[model samples]
Target: MGQDTKYIVGVDLGGTNIVSLLMNKRGEVLERDARLTLAKEGRERTISQITGSVSAVLEKGRELGISPDSLLGVGIGSPGPLNTKKGVIHFAPNLPGWREVPLVEILTQKLSMPVFLENDANAAALGEWWKGAGRNTSNLVLFTLGTGIGGGIIIDGEVFHGAWDTAAEVGHIIIHEEGLLCNCGTRGCLEAYASATGVVRRTVKAIKEGRETILTDWVQNRLEDITCELVYKAAQKGDKLCSWIVEETARYLGVGIASIVNILNPEVVILAGGMIKAKDLLFKPVREYAKRYALKDAIEGVSIVPAELGDDAGAIGAAATVLKRKGLL
Candidate 1:
């Protein structure tokens, strides 16, 4: 391979920040940079911010005596729903006023290089499959349990973009016909019960309803102070409410994964995101639930694992997007 094909820039764009990394085929990060997205500044300015961040990274590479042409191009992982076919962002709730922005074309024009766009969760799944926990597996599913739950399914080393390029939304899979109200106007979507927000909601409600717990001591009825991290900490201290909340959330996650296993039969299921940082307290229960609920045969050889890429999963996956877009995979 030539030098140009040896390196790529990965861009992870979020509502709050934009993280860029220069990486090689083996997943080595050579240089990294970050900037606040300031998305409220409006679409045009946000695009400019993205453009400038890429430019600055390229310039930094040049200053290190790296030839500009040696760069493969840029891979962008952004919040969706996006039009991957046309490289346009369909609608990103985090970024206000962002609608139908032709992100890929604009960046290509500005940088004079090819650009590839993908949903952040899908990109993260690809990233893990390529260089992280899901390595050596042809089929896999990834669930990111953070402020929200995002999902991606990788089948045969490729992201499964269903009709209209919006597939594998496991987070929205209805685990309960009549459960918690979801942000999507539905009842009991997995995300509505399994996300950090969901966990905190459950914890706070328990406290408000007079269920005994240590969480109340932290902030009495201050819902804003209730978070997954706080719940994890409380659970660590043996808080009954926090512990029960986690176990309940894990049950929903297990149900969601069981459905994915029954449908996709992937080789592995990857769990990533801030909430997973709870480690054994969260993971052990999730694995137990999956083993108990998932199809006996479908999960026979399946492995439930934690993601190795951590916070950089999206950025690295964005870089992988460049490779897949170029037909390198």
Candidate 2:
């Protein structure tokens, strides 16, 4: 590597997997590595996995003739309720026994380089804003719709951490008062309706209540076998009950997005995660309902689109955090 060339490593830490990337300031990814997180094994094991991931990436960089000095640092996108300013993860529900872990300090000490941390969703939003669907806009909102909903807000080219670094908890936005209970122990949260888990939960409940659907037959009366993707497939096959569920999920998402639009007026709203695989089946209804509910001016010119980065967004965005902090992005 040239003396003037520099690089950074970004790690996306999840309960199931850890993805790490070696990237340059120019947004070029040079080497990538992935491994299981083994979160249930305990905090010490998970931390070792994280450090091992970084080491693997750095070793790969060495093989590419990249000097260790050219590597600036590592950035981690972690599940939180974390204190980014202090680099402490207060608690992570998915990671057993992860409480007040000084991750940045630990990783910095282990790697002998600066380490930065951000909420995973926020890192993904930064990734999209920098190189994915929201690349053209400085202000954006991103919703990752998987087992649960996660969100990030980007304002004027930066993640909006708000006063306490938890400003954009979009999933918990109350879309339906007195509605379904959410995993977060809240009532009527958007996550309780639109998330993949929420969708499957509602579907299973409706089936048990004797609502007719192809999903029941497909699952051979095993309601537990039904999934959000299976629900979408049934809906696409013209199952009336499944169709209604999909539409209801889309409407709930639209309602949430409309509320966000009214308040933030973001340039673009990007939807990511597994549910996006439904594509037009999901986007069409969501866009329509958002237009129906949002203030006319607020809805105008705001684009709701799918994210482009896919699985790589979290790691790329994590790296972007490092670059942004280093004044190199």
Candidate 3:
């Protein structure tokens, strides 16, 4: 493909969904599609599903009179502990039984084009850095506040994978050395308190311990249905317990962010993911706490903001990865 032809394809693969985007080299989306992952059929089937989705997008592009041969390439963002260098997924806790899958090779062979793989969180960060909130900033950190906290860091316009390809794992950063237990077998990691699951877990624990709260009445037998949105609504309705739950969660997130500030000193920090939908109910407290805890100079000129790309961040970042790989950016 000619350098100035300006066409790329990006894919975001999640435990429950697969989304694809056709974009110009400038990162603007021309077309997009999303479908359920249906991961129950196992790794190979899941891979096929991804391939099918990508094929569908290309077919759509053809219908739009966009030649598939003119496409730059494909980029994919997926759950991590992956080897970006080799485009191999070592083990994705989110995707059941997927071990050491050579995803890049699979997609490349199927598409007859170059394919790149990166952790989803990292891809989102790159997306933000390239065309969203992190625009004009080279040093940036992004935290995805979803089922579990996921993180990505960009230093000098490149994603930092660290020595173990898990360098920017801000979620695992221990905010409380003896606090909550994490799925990774660690205690007090930031994810255990700030993520959607974390907020619900804390609320449930508080209620179980006889803390007076309205959540007790609002929640039925099924605690799993109690989402971060429910908590935010309860807080907005002046439920003291719910308010406390959100505040405490924000405090933990802020402290965790402060630590990132101290360590990486990124120019911008962006929050993305489902929980960010709470709007100011969450961002205000997190900003306040960050101000209180982060170093004066570090927090002084640093920008902390919500991600602007929303659901498109991962796919956009995946597309940017193709640009980066091709030395276009």
Candidate 4:
């Protein structure tokens, strides 16, 4: 097969889902598959799901007249405190029983091809840099604001893996002193204030304190059922408490982004994940606060925008990792 006809597979492994894609050299996805991760079923079952998703995509590629021999390899974006150099998952909080698993080695053995691994957030950053909002920019920072916040930094078209391969941990940045507790056992972390979990947590506290808001009625007075999305929806209808929560969330994000902007001076700051659904309500204040707190010169010409690739960012970024390693992208 000619080099031009060769393809690559990208896999995004999450606790809830495993998404796989087959892509040609031109960065077009030719085939894709997704399946439940069933991570609670243990490591072996999760690995099976990963491999099965890969096989499904490859089979679809075959139907498209693509040969298995024309495939380059596979790259995975997995949740981590992992070692990319060793392709070992030191541990993943979301994927229980995945301590020091030699995932690349296992996948390479099972699939009979080269395999690579990267932190999912870093892969998403690369994906955005290559084809999404960060395209045409060499330095970019991405914040994935979901249940918890995840971050990825791209410097000079490369994922910035710091000394311990744990760089771009933007969520843990201290935004306040002795403030709200974070899941990571730290107080005042940005994730404690800016993530979806944070928004819901704060709103729940407010409601419990007898702060009046339509969110309680929206969630049928079941405070435990309240979600960040509900908070945003209520805010859209001019619910005072929910609007305050949204604004607070945006302010927290702004403070975090300001710190990032001051330090990295990235060309673009991209916000991804479920919280982006809040759209202007979240973004307008975030931009304002970021600009307010950031260095005047540094803030100039920087664009803070929503991520474009959405769910596909991780998978596409995983493929970019392989192409980058192979010097094809």
Candidate 5:
């Protein structure tokens, strides 16, 4: 692929879904498809699912004047603890069957195209840096606050993958020492207090403690059906308990981000994920607390913003990885 290369493929691999996009160098997605990851079906089956989705998207692209051979390459953003240099998913806590899977090598061999891979959060950061909120800056940090908190750092205009490809595991930042048990078997990690699961856990714990709130009624006294969305809605309706839950989560989130600022001092912090849809409910407290904790010199000129690419960030970033490797981005 050269400067004039017109098409590339982006694949976003998640615990629950696999989304593929056929896109041009200009960032316009010409075709797309998404399906259940079914990772439990094991490594080979998941790989087949991903390749099938990519083929479907390419078929759609074929309808748009681009032939199969016209494609430049394929890029993927996958759940980590992986080695980008080796193109392997070292391990994914949420992906049951994934352990040291040589994903990029397999995909490259099967697709017969140059294939690139990065952690999904890192890919989202690259996507945002290339085409979304971080577009104007050379240094940026992106924290994806979703099922789990995932982060990526861009320094001097490039993704910093670190020596062992494990540099930016921001979610594992320990905040409260032994405060709460995390999915990773650690205590008091930022993910325990800020993710969707964390939010729900906090709310349920509050309800269990006999704290009076609208969430109790909203969930019909059943904690199993409670969600972060339900809690946010209750907060919006003036529920003090729910509001406190969100505000407190934001504070923990802010502390985690402030630590990043103190260390990396990136241009901006981009917060992404479904929970961020609450907008000010989450951003306001995070800024307030982050400002209180981060260094005056380090936090200066740094701003917090939500991701602009929405759900397409993964796919776009996946493509951007290939483009960057090819010196086209």
Candidate 6:
């Protein structure tokens, strides 16, 4: 390893998977490693998995003849409510036993490098802003629409972390006054209607209500087999039943995002996550509804696009934060 060689590590800590990356100054991903988070095993185990992944990426970099001895830092993208400045996860609903873990301090001690932390969604937004779909835009809003919706806001070039670090929670915005209950224990949240979980829930409810659908038969009457993807497939097959469900989901998302556009008027709205694979099926309704709901002047030329980085957004964004912090971006 050369003394002047510079590198940095990025970790995306998810409930199911932990991904690490070794990135160079030119923003090329030199090496990557991913492993199960095993979060249920407890905090120490999860952190160990993350650090091990980071080390594995670094080792892979070495195998590729990249002797980057001067590691700039390690950056972590974690599910929040987290104190980004203090580097503690106050509480992350996805990970059990992760209450107030001093992640930055612990990882720095373990890896012998400075560590920085950011909320995973915010990191993804930063990632998209730095190198993905939002590169051409200044004010951007991102929505990760999966099991639940995660939002990130970038105003100008910086993340909009509110006074309490809870800004840009676009998912929790109330769209329905008395709509479905959300996992957050709130009624009528955008997440309740827009998320993949919400799509499945709505499908199952329709099936139970005796609404005829191809999905019920496709899953062989096994309600659990119907997922958001299956719903999209069914819709693609021109199955009217599932098509309406997916359209309604997009409607929910569009209306939710409409609130964001009306309030902040971001230059671009990036929709990410597995659900985005639905492509036109998802974007069409979202755009239509958003245009209808948001102020015309607010959204005239705002681009609503899919995230380009996909799963890499979080990790890259985490690392990007380090560069951004050093003013190296």
Instruction: Report the Cα RMSD per candidate.
Output: 1.5, 1.2, 1.5, 0.9, 1.6, 1.9
TM-score of each: 0.96, 0.98, 0.96, 0.98, 0.95, 0.95
Worst 10 residues of 2 by lDDT: 1-10
Query: What digit string (tens of lDDT, one per residue) describes model 3 on residues 116-142?
Result: 988899999999999999999989999
Cα deviation of 229, candidate 2, in Å: 0.4
Ranking according to lDDT, highest score first: 2, 4, 5, 6, 3, 1
* lDDT assessment of candidate 3: 0.88
lDDT (Cα) of model 4: 0.93
TM-score of 3: 0.96
Residue range 15-78, candidate 4, lDDT tens digits: 8999999998888989989999999999999999999999999999989998899888999999
Badly placed stretches (over 4 Å) of model 1 are 1-5
Q: Indicate which candidate wins on TM-score.
A: 4
Give each model's whole-structure lDDT: 0.87, 0.93, 0.88, 0.93, 0.89, 0.89
Residue-wise lDDT of candidate 6 within 1-329, one digit each (tens)? 55336787888999999989898766678888999999889888998999899989988888877654578888899998998889999998879998889999998899888899999999999989988999967899999998889899999889899998888888899988787888878799988888889888998998899888888888899999889899999999998889999888878887888888989989999999999899998898889988988899998998999999999999999998888888887
Cα lDDT of model 1 by residue, 1-329, tens digit: 46445778899999998988887766777778889898989988888888888887777877777677778789999998998889999899999998888999999998898899999999999989988999999999999987778998999989999988889788899998899999889998998999988988888788778898777678775767887898999998998888888898888898899888999999999999888778899888888898889889997888888999988888999998988888876
Q: Taking the tens digit of each residue's C-alpha lDDT, what string does model 2 give over 6-113? A: 888999999899999999887889999999999989998999999999999999999998888888889999999998899999999999999999999988998899
In candidate 3, how many clashes are counted? 0
Cα displacement (angstroms), candidate 5, residue 96, comes to 3.1
The residue-by-residue lDDT of candidate 5 on 203-231, one tens digit each, is: 99988998999877877888899998888
Look at candidate 5 and tell me the lDDT of residue 278. Answer: 91
User: Which is better, 1 or 4, measured by lDDT?
Assistant: 4
